[model samples]
Target: MNDDPRRIHCDRHGAQRPAFVCGHLVSGVGLGFVEPEGPQDEDASDEQAAWCDRCETARLAGGGWTAQSEAAAGITLVCAVCFEASRARNTHWMEGVARGWRHTDAR
Candidate 1:
């Protein structure tokens, strides 16, 4: 009977895939949450999550996460897999797909 809320049970991923993300991600409206720069930990988990530029500004407006900023963020809990998917959709990419380049090539 190990009851730890951090170790949540996701309906899709079974159990023990604790993660959290901003409201925009849950709503599928990714807002450019870039990945942390430099070397990453070997764990390879994107569960760190992030906030949009606007939200971040508000959060740090007074040098910290104020009550209003926290409310504006509206953090949401999600499975590890789901978190990864959100990160993929939100993070910026250095390269564009061939299909996207096709338009420039035609002109």
Candidate 2:
């Protein structure tokens, strides 16, 4: 059996899958995100990770994840499928362009 702490059952997925996302994303509606660079180059199955726009602004204002910014993020664990759903639900072309997300498609 896999002993990975990240492997947990999701009420929706009902299976062990490793993933996590911020609270805003779990309840996101076109909420943009800031993630590691080069997302467009990666495949969909690549590790899904992102923090919402509010967190990004706080991070920039604080010059990094200060205690306040970290608290505001409220990171939560979720299944891989849920992570993908959040990603899809939140990502928007116009929003990405406005936020200057570095992706070829956003141009």
Best candidate per TM-score, number?
2
lDDT of 2 by residue, 1-107 (tens): 54666577888886667665778999887887667565353344445568888888998899866898878889787788888888778887787667687656755
Q: Write candidate 1's Cα lDDT for 21-86 as tens digits.
A: 768766564465633456665875655656665676776685756788878878788777877777
Which candidate leads the pack in lDDT?
Answer: 2
**Global lDDT of each model?**
0.65, 0.76
**Cα deviation of 7, candidate 1, in Å:** 2.5
User: What TM-score does prediction 2 earn?
Assistant: 0.69
TM values, all candidates: 0.62, 0.69
Candidate 1: lDDT over CA atoms?
Answer: 0.65
Mind sharing the TM-score for model 1?
0.62
Regions of candidate 1 where Cα sits further than 4 Å from its true position: 1-6, 34-47, 95-107
For residue 86, give model 1's deviation from the true position in Å. Answer: 0.6
